[model samples]
Target: MDLFDAINQRHSYRGPLLADPVPRTDLRRIIQAGLQAPSGRNAQTTEFIIIDDPVLLAKLQAMHPANQAMQQAPAMIACLIDRQPAAVYEGYNFQIEDCAAAVENMLLAITALGYASVWIDGWLRLEQRADRVAQLLMLPTDKKLQILLPIGRPAEHWPQKERKPFAQRAWFNCYGAEETPCQ
Candidate 1:
């Protein structure tokens, strides 16, 4: 798919996924897209762990008792950020921003590559799930699991959610002052 199409199609897929496994090669490509994302001060504080093992998948699945997508995804990517990231520029650690950029890139890549995934961050934040996942993956104390993406072929289809008009959300010269903004 082209870049625009990927951007348009990339949505949070919370539905069940097909049982077919996602190839390691594709997973690598997806993660590579994330790695290419621009980081604040080029700190590049985000790291990733790709998981495809059935045993481990089962363990992760158990964490999300209500999310079918989490249970059925054939693969997953864990975004890790430094727990105590050193300030790279302006005494600011951009791990969170870097991680978000990376996740968005990966989500687009996932759409472009004919796979689907959901950004599973909030759920991970609940119930100390991120900590558990970090422990499960044997991450170092410096690293914390910041995001999780469940990857697989979607079992069901859903319409892309509508987005608000550009005119309402954006403006040419100032904030929300466009009587008629050019597209």
Candidate 2:
């Protein structure tokens, strides 16, 4: 598929995901796309924990309170970053931003490959929970969990969501200034 089609077709599939396993080659390609994302100061801190093992997936599902759909996913990706490199930031760490960009790229690539995916954000901010997940994944001591993404083929229909007009959400040089209206 073309880039435009991928962007337009991408959506957070929340219903059910097919049980068919995602090929490791495809997963590697998706992760490679993520790695292509830009990094701050060339730190290249983004790390990916691609989990296709059913037992491990179940372990991660147990971490959630009531996310049954997680088990339906054939595979999931845990986006992470090594803080040792990110710590070089003077005040703020851009690891989260960098990893998030990588995740978005992966999501787009998943869509392009005729697959479905959803962003799992809350998993990264829970109290001591993310730390446990990191340990479970055997991540490096300096690595920190950022986000998770469950990917698979869609088992249910997912229609495109409505979006606001460009004029309302866009500005030329400042917020609240409608510089370019949708035509």
Candidate 3:
């Protein structure tokens, strides 16, 4: 599918993914797509840790709450940032922005490849718990774990989510005013 088609078709997938392993080549392609996303000052701070080992995946899955579906995913990605880079700037973490864009690109690519994915933020953790997760991953004390993404072939079909009419969400050169769906 073309870029536009991929964008339109992409959505969050939290259901079961096929047990089949994602091909290394395809995984590389997904990572490449992420790298292609724009970065802050070209900082390109995002880093990806793709986890496929069942044992390791199992361990990580155990760290979370009752999310059986997470254990079933054939692949998972840990989006992280180097604190050193972000520290160079005051109140700016380019890695988070960079990785987020990267993940968005990968999510779109996943749909294009007839797969599914979900963005599971690690933000649900309290400070202490979040720190534990970082320790488990052996990330530096300064580095941060942005999110965990589970990806695979969806076991069930899902429809597009409901949304407010475009008119209600858009505006004309101002906040909350007249604007048509097509502009």
**Residue-wise C-alpha lDDT for candidate 2, range 15-45, written one tens digit per residue:** 7788899999999999999999887776777
Which candidate wins on lDDT? 1
**Residue pairs with backbone atoms closer than 3 Å in model 2 (clashes):** none
For candidate 2, the 10 contiguous residues with the lowest summed lDDT are 83-92
Candidate 2 whole-model C-alpha lDDT, 0 to 1: 0.83
lDDT of each residue in 1-183, candidate 1, tens digit only: 999999999898899899999999999999999999999988788999999999999999988978888989899999999998899887878889999999999999999998989989888888888999998999998899999999999989876899998977977766777676545
- Displacement of the residue 47 alpha carbon in candidate 3, Å: 0.7
* Per-residue alpha-carbon lDDT of candidate 3 for residues 1-183, written as tens digits (9 for 90 to 100): 898988877887766666888887778778888889988878888887787888787777776545545767778877777757644366665676788899999888888888788887744355565566677678877777777777788888876577788778877777776654333
Q: List lDDT for all candidates, in order.
A: 0.91, 0.83, 0.75
How many clashing residue pairs are found in candidate 3? Answer: 0
Candidate 1 regions with alpha-carbon error over 4 angstroms: 179-183
> What does the lDDT read for residue 115 in candidate 3?
78
Return the TM-score for candidate 3, rounded to 2 decimals: 0.83
- Tell how far residue 37 is off in model 2, in angstroms: 0.6
